[model samples]
Target: MPTSDVVVVMVPFVAQGHLNQLLHLSRLISTYNIPIHFISTTTHCRQARDRLHGWHAHDNFIKFHPLHDPDFTSPNPEPNTTTQFPTHLQPSFNSSLHLRHPVADIIRSLAKTSRRVVVVHDSIMSYVVQDVKFIQNAETYIFRALSVFYILCFNLIRLGKELPFTLEMKLRLPDATATVSQEFTEFLKLQYSHQTFHVGNIYDSSRVIEGKFLEYVEKDEIMGKRHWAVGPFNPVEISPDVSSSAQQDRHACLKWLDKQPEKSVIYVSFGTTTTFLECQIRELALGLEKSEQRFLWVLRDADKGDVFKKDTVRRLELPEGFECRIEGRGLVVREWAPQPEILGHFSVGGFMSHCGWNSCMEAMTGGVAIIAWPGHSDQPHNACLLVDVLGVGLLMREWACRDELVTSVMVETMVRKLMGAGEGVEIRKRATELGGELRRSLGEGGGGRKELDSLISYITR
Candidate 1:
């Protein structure tokens, strides 16, 4: 007997989005009856386990292994000192730099006991693709975890000449041609001529397998054909609880929304991690008030951290029933909301968002236009895609403000545009078309679905 069988190992970077992708992938892998060992820092591993609480038998086949800090074990690094766990240990920590060594070591150990071990990884940890011996599985599949459109944008930049400024500078510039290399300008030319946008190419295999948006555009060959993009996957079913937190919030919003007329509410949420200064929060509240539009706001208690204690969820000082003032008009509140279900709600007309990819996807898929309020990281890039490339969203100014945040005027303008009040109808039409295309990508026999099935076959075989 070979005494070796396939073991799938995943070490997702510690972040909500990254973890969500890995967990979704893990669920897909589990359906194949393959053994899986998902490795993570002690805290993260605990959290992942908690998400699936009571759902599975705690066993070897589907195991959650915690990597604890060596210092915390027994012999302290020194009598009074302790070794620091790698920064990747917590979801709130920056994970890019610290995960490589620990992950390489874990995969190496797994290889010793399994004859056919495979490493499934996220794009954020793309460095693993270069370490062959560390992951000596019969197969190693690099899971690309970005949308094909985003990947295309990245690849086009890579394929062309270096631009004078950074990619960010180029995207942020109001005029597209001002900051980029001429070669890129020409490439984008060919792209738009063909009804495509030249999204540069930097891919994650996990994304192609997990990204639910690849089925929209026509697929073409690029990078001379890489082993990547076997995915851009979409599982036919998402467990009701898979996104329960977001859903729970969504239900609450619906209660307020049910009282309003169709397409009357503008939804605002900055996502789980992003926080704004008190000044900015107040501006948003006032902006909602000024817009005179009915709204459902999900405000986090920690928006005023340091000023408030951790247990102080109740001391949320608002603009004095600004809730009462906006009464019958707007609802200002806190707690997690079911974002996707809310975006898809009939009452939601526009979204004031932080432009996270998942949020962008859900909003667009639901035919809701966005007021892009990008905070950091890939959000700015995604905002560019939404505003410049897709034309379905409006861009909020970069500066933070409470009075000026989403001022009543801006809110009303966005509402008119998003709700198709006048010339805005065109934007709505474009958004609706994109939603249809996004749906087609996930529909039965669609590219995303087919790709997902192909990924499952690859993992099981």
Candidate 2:
């Protein structure tokens, strides 16, 4: 196995967070002169190709292997764009999950070439890896883009380490708030079913699983296989080189930040997968509006209501004219926000985040205080680590569980406390220290660097 020419094929879950992390990992590996081919369905492939258009790699060095499931017809297809999260509720999104044969065909073609074919997939898509291996001489690996705690806790349950606690009881953790319902559902789903994406659990473990724990599984083959914890992939490193659309958005955001006081603004955003019921959104909207603090809110579905209308994909109705109401004090980012850039800014004092591991890495690395609002899945646990274990930030309880409804008053109080001086000083300081530590870990001779090197070595071994 030679390092120079071996072809590593990376496939990601349909969601952009997973797709973006694997893409960044490919960029890191592109320097080895390895031909990296990314595979996904048509929509995901298009976005991947677009992002790599001006990539630093050599010409023809990187490519995409996109497949269409011939048997699965998309129902709400063309109207839904890549920017929005595709809920399985949409009849059009069925193709996102049914990729076994389409991806298998990609491996078959790559296997014909003299170079070895290794398929690295997101855990949500791990089911397809088995099918890829059945193709001639192909290999399979798993790359998880989730936080280590999320991985460790979930797997400990599967391994029965949390025995006798009973599934109904909260899975006790070193972090203060032990995960109960959300985590249990994750263990049950991943242990039993592969289709983790569910409408009710919106952003639940059903959509993603803890692949990091797979390394600990007692299988000889799994032990021998290549696995990498190659993430909280830094967006700051990749922000300087962004797609044209991304650059435009980045420019607008940075320009706004330039005028603000240092560390005075709290940046708010939920990753693509978290969808809010109207009441929840109203609470968040009013909360931010009434908080009377300088902020930026990237609302994924600002204009949405109880129904999905074909015409409303681009325009969402917030607490009508909410942007105007907050005018100078806040900015509501409706389109895709450049999160890494915002977090890395000096003026960004705090982050009101979804507690997605990726956002945690960015905010912590930037040394920004957190207003942890974990709506679903591992977020509540991620929030616990930030607030209780790490002592980095405070939790926004209004939006904790998926069904939890936060009020404007609650949101306002958190905003003032997080953005104002005094008690928040210690939390901010802790977040800064943690951010520095994480950045160092990903930097020269850092743990992330060593793991990445080992991954490269495994592929070329």
Candidate 3:
């Protein structure tokens, strides 16, 4: 089949982290002139297109297909990237359970064109897509947006292999309490609760990234399935002109960064999906206030939408007198701040992050040290790799496995250790060096590009 006739259909979870990684993967694959059909919720499709600055020119080579919610009959049917999306209606968009039919239709249509179609969907969709073996000239691949470390651990859990219980011990078992949500609880349970590999079912293949730039662990002998390491799919450079409704926050963040000393500020965020209890939120606020370091904090309110209208933002309350205490040294923004844009800033020295794989990859690309504060999912494992294996991150000690309400003192100590002069110096140096290595490994003849090319060849051959 001709390269032009080879189409890759990519489906990402509705959340930002999954969508961002898969969107970049779409970019990498489309560079070879092969067409891509990226499936996402209508709101998320517009979100992707808006953030994807250069791809406006790739109209013919790429397409963003929207997945609709048939049950949304209350009259507000527009797309939403942030809190504009009603809380009750969000599950319909986030899960593959609802997307199964639409995705199947996409596969069937592509098969009819006689084009070689490869369906690359988020790992959560495994059970639903596993049975989609009837399409002609179509292959399904599971795109694990997490790291090899996380994937290996998950596979072990599924096989009931004994695992060392360390940090994130809550997720070590199925019945452990969750800080995330009921929806995430289901996603967390799906992998271990079922036997994932079924002959002629499940997936034809799975893909992962080289975590902390380490060697890939051989898994075929254990799982009886092939896994491809094709990433560090995080883009080396992010365009600053990407459009978003939160333009004011972006401008304020950049303008504020301009006034700070180089490498003197830490960027703190827990991502869009990670849930935080009221006390955890209070502890973080008090900790940053006590750290005495210049910082930018992304704080979102748990009870309401991110925005009330234009010019107003909603977020949980901070410690009383919090702003005045850190007057010259802190700036807080509600809702999603432009993470890539912030991380790329030279004045930004380190990140206090949830250690989500996408956030890890982005921080590495920008060459910043991380203070791994994992909250949920495979994040704790990713944090383990960052701090223990890669030597680029420091653990908060208090944020390990559960909703442990870390006190202000604990938060202050970790923040100070991360940003102040001392052991963090070596970690910062290593992080910078590793960042360079990751960037080089994805450039022109880099391993990631080569692996992607090989994947395309295999699917079409």
Using TM-score, give the best candidate's number. 3
Worst 10 residues of 2 by lDDT: 198-207
Pick out the ten consecutive residues of candidate 3 with the lowest summed lDDT: 199-208
RMSD of 3: 6.0
Query: What ranking of all candidate models by TM-score puts the best one first?
Result: 3, 2, 1
Arrange candidates by lDDT, highest first: which order?
3, 2, 1
lDDT string for model 1 (187-280, tens) is: 3353333222212222322332224324322244543233334222223223344466755643556677778888778888876445454555
Compared with the true structure, all predictions reach lDDT values of 0.55, 0.62, 0.66
Task: Give each prediction's root-mean-square deviation over alpha carbons.
Answer: 9.9, 7.2, 6.0
Q: Which model, 1 or 2, shows the larger TM-score?
A: 2
Q: Please give the lDDT score for candidate 2.
A: 0.62
> What are the models' TM-scores?
0.68, 0.77, 0.80
Q: Give one digit per residue, the lDDT tens place, for model 3 in 347-374.
A: 9999998887778877887789999877
Q: Which stretches of candidate 3 lie over 4 Å from their true place?
A: 1-4, 50-59, 72-90, 93-95, 127-131, 163-219, 222-225, 239-250, 302-314, 398-401
Q: Model 1 Cα displacement at 69 (Å)?
A: 6.3
Please identify which of the two predictions, 2 or 3, would achieve the higher lDDT against the true structure. Answer: 3
In model 2, what lDDT does residue 443 have? Answer: 71
Q: Name the TM-score of candidate 3.
A: 0.80
